[model samples]
Target: MASSTIIVMGVSGSGKTTVAEGLARRLDVPLAEADDFHPPANVAKMSAGTPLTDEDRAPWLDALGAWLAERDLAGGGGVMTCSALKRRYRDRLRAASPDVFFVHLTGDFDLIERRMRERKGHFMKAGLLRSQFADLEPLQPDEHGVAIDIGPAPDELVERAAEAVQRA
Candidate 1:
């Protein structure tokens, strides 16, 4: 959509990666998985069932921001799957590029928690779901983006999000 960098954002198990990949396919751009950028320490903490403090997330977010900035400067765009739980976290990404946009995936906590429980081999624990929701500040009034419920299947959700991006 308009060649801007897209951030498919939501807490873990909300299908951010699935949606981002589908959108990138539709948009003909690359897809970046936020989990790939996490430092070993961050991964270790998550695997140990410890939630990341803002301090712990700063470096990871910076690395992601830098990636976005570099892609933007090169006049190319991609979709990134990140939690971006807090407003400040999102602001950090937006600071990377003027055309940065977010797509918030909203869903019932129980639904997502169930999904998390069903998932295997992910560093993030199902117990961390509540902390994520607690920290989340949904897209603000002035934010440039779209918010969609994550109840549907991946294909439908991606289509809806892509439509929103097109409209934006």
Candidate 2:
């Protein structure tokens, strides 16, 4: 079974980063925040409460792909936190590394919005929650991914994700 490279995907407030970091730590792999791969233009647009088009996301996704490829070639892996809101976005990631897997954090919109509103020091503001949900396409059955509800405790979520990865 493939033992390397996982993408943690969800909308703005679904704990993608937290789960990714936790998984990376548990797996003893590096972790990457896909937000860091975003270009300045995308960040500026989001900061202005604007939703990014597919064009705006292509380069950022490509960068993520490159990072994954690099890590895989090094015979190690990393957990990357990416919104991966669309099917095409996930496809791009899979294309870069066929073995790449995704952990999809799922949660209720109300809960997510509430969390987003209370969160601070995050580039994605609460104002963009609706747009993010609108753009998100749940992982398809054929996709190399697993979905976990965030209704559980952080430790439970991480444990479930780790188990899923082990089985994947």
Candidate 3:
């Protein structure tokens, strides 16, 4: 099978990391957390309950793009997590790795908020959930991806996502 870079995307509390990790493990590929690619300033801002503007995300997106590009060039599959809240951001990722696929995790606001509150040691505060949802633009008809409801167990979600990617 041809190697494809898979981006597990959603708002902070939507279980992107957990799902991505499972997918990566199942696929036997490297996993990259988009949060780790953020610069200190961006992390600090998010930690302080501030939403990141497009400008603030530019460099971070570029870093993620580079990571995907590298994986593509090496003919290695991988999974990564990102908010990817806008069409433009996803476009940038596609530009970097044309074969990149997205698995969009989504859930109700209340459920997401509760998950965010329960998470510990994360830089993103629960207060930023509103901003994330406000900025999110769901995958469009033309996008190459799947949108999976984040209501199932993590293992089940990974299975669903893996099946979707296989179909893609």
Positional deviation of residue 84's Cα in model 3 after best superposition, in angstroms: 0.4
- For lDDT, the strongest prediction is 3
TM of each candidate vs. truth: 0.97, 0.97, 0.98
| lDDT of candidate 2 over 104-133, digit per residue (tens) | 999999999998988898888898999888
Cα TM-score of candidate 3: 0.98
* Residue clash pairs of candidate 3: none
Model 1: ten consecutive residues of lowest lDDT? 70-79
Predicted structure with the largest TM-score when compared to the true one: 3
Better of 1 and 3 by lDDT: 3
The regions of model 2 sitting more than 4 angstroms off are none
lDDT of 3 by residue, 23-122 (tens): 9988999999999999999999998988988999999999999999999998988899999999999999999998899999999999999998998999
Deviation in angstroms for 82 in model 2?
A: 0.4
In model 2, which range of ten residues has the least summed lDDT? 1-10
Write down the TM-score for model 1.
0.97
Candidate 3: RMSD to truth: 0.8
Q: lDDT of model 2 at residue 116?
A: 92
